[model samples]
Target: MTDVLARRVQASPDATALVGVGGAEWTYRELDEHVERVAGRLAALGIAGEHLGCLLETRPATAVLVHAAARLGCVLVPLNTRLTPTELDSHVERAELAALVCGADTADTAVELSVDVPTASVDDTEHTEITVLDSVSPAEFAPASRDADDPAVMLATSGTTGEPKLVVLTTENLRSSAVASAFRLGITPDDRWLDPLAVYHMGGLAPIVRSALYGTTVVIPGEFDARATLNALERFDCTGISLVPTMLRRLLAAGSLADSLRFVLLGGAPASEELIERCEKRGVPVHPTYGMTETASQVATARPGEAFAHTGTVGRPLLDTDLSVLGGDGKSVDIGETGELVVSGPTVFAGYYGDPDATARAFSERGFHTGDVGHRDAGGRLWVTGRRDEMISTGGELVAPGEIARVLRSHPAIDDAGVVGLPDPDWGERVGALVVGDVTDAETVRNYCRERLAGFKLPRTIAFADELPRTASGTVARRVVRERLLDNGD
Candidate 1:
């Protein structure tokens, strides 16, 4: 892949590249300069072809370094600031990070990782002087004696599987994914995106990489609050935004978003059909997508158009991408038949970083097994069923809790929902429900289900809570909720 920073700056050096929520806007020219300066500093520090843990907020310096690392062939290991010190330490050790670059706000967390591997504070960066990169070009940084297969980034996984794992990202994989996302979302120079996602995830990385690729302005959030995000839409004159289902649901329910919006790319989790319809009626210009860290960002997306009909279904695979469904018995399932969603393409990661066991488990000679269960429709739209590990077997029948949750959440009363199979004496396992809302206790919810679903589908027990458990990435940790319900008295 071509050097992203070099290419974009060469094409549109005058365009605005980065904008912080608090202050500071760096143009493409300025961004390129800072990247060279920092990489020069890193070369002085003797950090090359190695991992460096970065614990900074969304800022121009952090972004510049991501490219600088690519220029030097150094692997960037971005540590999530939200993670506890213990979690942070685990990642630092795992990535074998040689240094830490932190934003002032997250300096304490960075210190926890280490006091030794020199920490550079982004708050110390001065936006007063624009360092012109006139003489030094990114083209001067020739490719070292390394293949494209080498790791450029080491992004930590959400740990939904077992422990939080580090994903080795190659320049080619990230490059392909960003190009694919532009086509998937119809990104353009005029399309200014208000991004509220955490920089640790691919959702956040895609925009930064895209900014360097497309020369578009991406407004970063100082902090994430639904109301603030809504306010910024008009304040920043943002054309589009990326948000998970929960974030969008809160924004829509709060009724606080500014008037002008082109498309709200809602993904990270499949949203309720009601949520999509509400946006449609209100002219929110909603576009639901399907992606994960493994795929870089989005593999399939449903843009707002008449030709695109399915709402819940994640649209067709992007250009030069491939997807298939493996049935429960391990064969290609027919359209409409549920199976594991397997993705194989240029954008797909080669394997999990430093974990051969995980790499082996995730893929075979066939393709990269996503562990997500989904099936294609007549229109070739993929409707995600649930995760393979999330499947609950009650008696002899396999039950996908996501199916039950989708049906239950459709009711106006239910705000948030999760379904799990609980161990039972006679049936071996019985369905369980965890909901966040006012209406319906265990019996009432069970009776409500009886009206719409079979007796077996009804939750034997219903639990009410202020909120469902969520991973750092904002996906509902269904397994965590199940364990919580089973272990703690509810």
Candidate 2:
């Protein structure tokens, strides 16, 4: 199709396009000019049609670069700002980037990187070639005409279990995803979506794309602050917002949410039933979603009013998307049978960047084989059990960590819970749990789980933590939990 932002500006030039947390606002026309100016600067640096790495925080500058990349026909590689220098280096090398862009917050990490590429800083005070939106004297420019299959952006998967892979999303993939999301969650011309997720994650990046396609507004807080987000909802008259369960929990605890909010899209990880119940009780309109990096942002989302009824279910697939639960023989399993989940549709990513073997293994004749295990009920609702790789096999019995974690969260004393397989000489691998709550006595929590879960599914070992480690997307970091258990000599 055509340039998303260019088309939006044509439709409604005076509509508010973006609002920063610090009271900075830009209309559609102004934002288009900013993107064009930034694209001109990149053109001067010979960055056209090349892979560019961006290590920036959530701000207006980051959104400008995202649109500018599309205009220049360059592949934008959104780097995670939370990654360490070593981790950043690995991604830079993997992408074979030609140039790098950094915001003021990540300038030090950009300098420390070993890659020998031209670097530009997006800070206004910094006297660099990339001085924030440096004027290039208004001139005639047009977005490069691109094929539908051309790669638009490359985002890294959350490497909770292993090394993250760079997913290559095509122009069509993004367009389809935005269109499908709008169809599922009706879009209004006056809709303003509040975004609090990091730009590196798909959850954050998709809103910018969707807003452009729908010609609407996106209000972004500088970062995720419970109080600030609550204020933003009322201040901006936000009709919709996206958040992880952790952020939602904090916001609910802060106080009553704004009545102006129409919908709260919750995902990034499996949401606990207790959390969903709390939202329902508070009159919060939450739509529990299930998606991954491979499927753009959301493949399936529960409807607004139906969320409380289906509690833990992620609802059905979005428009034009198909999902199936397959057995070991690669055939569709019966309803309510837990197996691997596979997705197929225009919204699916083209492939993993520069990894043919992985690209081949990830997809089959059926579709993209998501390594997640879940089932679909007769009513066609999907329920995610856990990751196939994360399953705990103890005493020759398989146990899903999500099943145990859900039960632990039901206890009034437990605020959050994460389960992992711990080494045990007797059982091969014993069920271990890390919990955050008021209760310090392990026996009391274990007894609580004993009533809800089966004997084999019960956690044999329990430890208390002030808070669990989380990735940038706010999902509990299982890998970190396993490492900490080893370090603690448990």
In model 1, pairs of residues that clash are none
Cα lDDT tens digits, model 2, 1-490, are 4478998999999999999977789999999998998888888777788898888887888889889888888898999998887778889999989888887788777777876667887775353534343543434445688899999889998877678899999998899988988988888889999988888888899898889889889988788888888898988889999988888999998877889887899999888899999988889988899998899889899986667898889989998899989988999999999899999999899999999999999999889998999999989999999989888999999898998999988888888988899888999998888889998888888788888888998888777789988875566798777776656523
Q: What TM-score would each prediction reach against the true structure?
A: 0.91, 0.96
**What are the Cα lDDT values of the candidates?**
0.75, 0.86
Q: TM-score of model 2 relative to the true fold? A: 0.96
Candidate 2 stretches greater than 4 Å from native? 125-142, 486-490
Candidate 1 overall Cα lDDT vs. reference?
Answer: 0.75
- Pick out the ten consecutive residues of candidate 1 with the lowest summed lDDT: 127-136
Candidate 2, residue 92: lDDT:
94
Q: For residues 316-377, what per-residue lDDT tens digits would candidate 1 score against the true structure?
A: 78876788888766789998888998888888887777789988988866688888888888
> Per-prediction count of colliding residue pairs?
0, 0
